[model samples]
Target: MARKKIVFVIVEGPSDQDALELLLNKIFDRDRVFVHVTYGDITSRAGNTPANILKKVQAEVGKYAKNNHFEKSHFKEVIHIIDTDGTYVSEDRVIEDETVGKTIYSPDSITARDKQSIVERNLSKRKNVDKLQATPLIWGKIPYSVYYMSCNLDHVLYNKQNSSDEEKENDSFEFARKYKSDTDGFKRFISESDFSVGGDYQSSWEYIKEGKHSLERHTNLGLCFPDSER
Candidate 1:
């Protein structure tokens, strides 16, 4: 049988690109799959979204194509991994606002409560800090997954195995892996937390911890970050 074609991913940062690349590698055996994932600095400190991100993607791909002498057809398909925070003040709400900061309880205070509770509370505050809008039609051709999550930069970069200072200093892939891992944690944290004003944090926490299906969902999605899948 013919080998499957490789996929190209254009991401917001070098790290973002790496994370997905890692996931693909982990899920698919190296011998069976091949992927070329690259990233460009699509962020402006201004914020990123589908509309604005595509511009960056085009420019980066153009540069890569020019330097490598490759055509768009060289790859099976292109996937633009972008963060969709939802809502917008401009084209595609793909970007984020840096000037604002939402004050949620510190992680230290929340750690004493429950992990799931902390996740929901922080995620709830994401809207206040940044406008996250999920947009389709990024590449104008290829299908992609534009992840829309609450702005949790610290978790995104800090809580994963790939996030060691040593890894970050040495390889860009390590940094990206950490960020991707955080995305998984964030998802799990929120899904388990009861966003309802009076919901019990403890109950939700137990459901996430003891419930087989719930834990599996989190791990499956969480493992989406991938370690060696590359």
Candidate 2:
């Protein structure tokens, strides 16, 4: 029998990997997809940034090719999913004068201009290296909060503020507990979501301000799915 084709997905952490694994499995045969966690943020000096992660991916592909005596073509796609973390601003920066509510500086607080600047800055810093250009890279702008009904997955899952990193790890499982049980419903939610005007961090912030879950709605995981599934 021919070996199954694999799709590689590099995520920020285990929670992200878990959440995507559930969705990917629904869209394709479980055996055909592989989701990996970078275990840290892109800004960190770890194997998580776009350039470093791609290196890891290439290494893995090489290993598989050597082990199985197969060609690198065995892999179909290499997708990178990362959170914008509110345009790389520190969450400690507090918004002091909001009368309606004590709003903090977050990705939701960033303007379109600032968001674009941040994206450009990050991209500029990316090392010039060859990547799997045919792959589809998805950005989860600001964070996964854009996906879970416009709320932070940590707060929604654990119902607490200032959650620990370990607590945050459970986000995917909690999301699956609610959303994955009804696969078709979840699929419809993803397919019909229209969260942003322009599908960028600034647009996501606008939708978030309107008390909408637009970010979660606009997240594009379609590349991981088959045409029929999408």
Candidate 3:
């Protein structure tokens, strides 16, 4: 019998994989779902550009394939899930404050100790995300797509704009338990909730990148499901 192909999902953290892995597995019941945790936002990583991001993703996929003795044909698609992080906001909107030790995300603005650095990171991230959205294939063999959770996965799921590590893990665990046996219910929440962006894939991307939408609660993940489910 032929093996089911892989739905390789790339995410930014273990919590992300944990929160959605079970539900994603249920959604793609006939195929395998493997979520790759990137640890940090790859789009904002140092030295990452539009062109090299492709190579970076390919490297991650290749590493997995080699480890599993899987060939390129084993993959059905590479779906990247990342935080929007208000990456498209204007430089003026990035505020600098000394009291805060780390970056803070809000629907209308981002605050950090270093405003210029935040602005620069946003600029770089915006470019890379735009590039990835335009690239339909990666490694010349895998169908690739990227989705956003603005200002991040935690926000979209837990409505927590910014959370401590302990808080994040707790929230993610609770969320997972909530829908562990209800994949269809999970699907509806993402597709029909107020936070769910109402549009096709490309249009959702377009909407998030506009104004402060990237920092708001919005997701286009419904498009990743099968057409029948959608």
- TM-score to native of every candidate shown: 0.40, 0.54, 0.97
- Output the TM-score of candidate 1: 0.40
Model 3 segments more than 4 A misplaced: 228-230
Write the residue-wise lDDT of candidate 2 on 1-230 in tens digits: 77777665666677767666776766766447766665664433334455564455455445555776755555665555544333323322222342433222222342332444434533432321112222233221111111222223333233333346676667667767777667776665555545322344334334433322322223434323355221
- Tens-digit lDDT string for candidate 3 (1-230): 88999999999998898899998999999999999888998899999998798899888999999999999988999999989999988887889998998799988999999998998899899999999988889877789998889899999999998899888888889999999998889999988999998667788888998888988899998878875222
- Using TM-score as the measure, the top candidate is 3
C-alpha positional error of residue 37 in candidate 2 after TM-score superposition, expressed in Å:
0.9
Clashes of 2: 4
Tens-digit lDDT string for candidate 1 (10-44): 55544444444555444443322233344322332
- Distance from true location, Cα of 196 in model 2, Å: 6.6
Error of 2 at 178 (Å): 2.3
TM-score for predicted model 3 compared with the true structure: 0.97
lDDT of 1: 0.35
Q: Which ranges of candidate 2 are over 4 A from the true structure?
A: 43-71, 88-107, 110-163, 194-218, 228-230
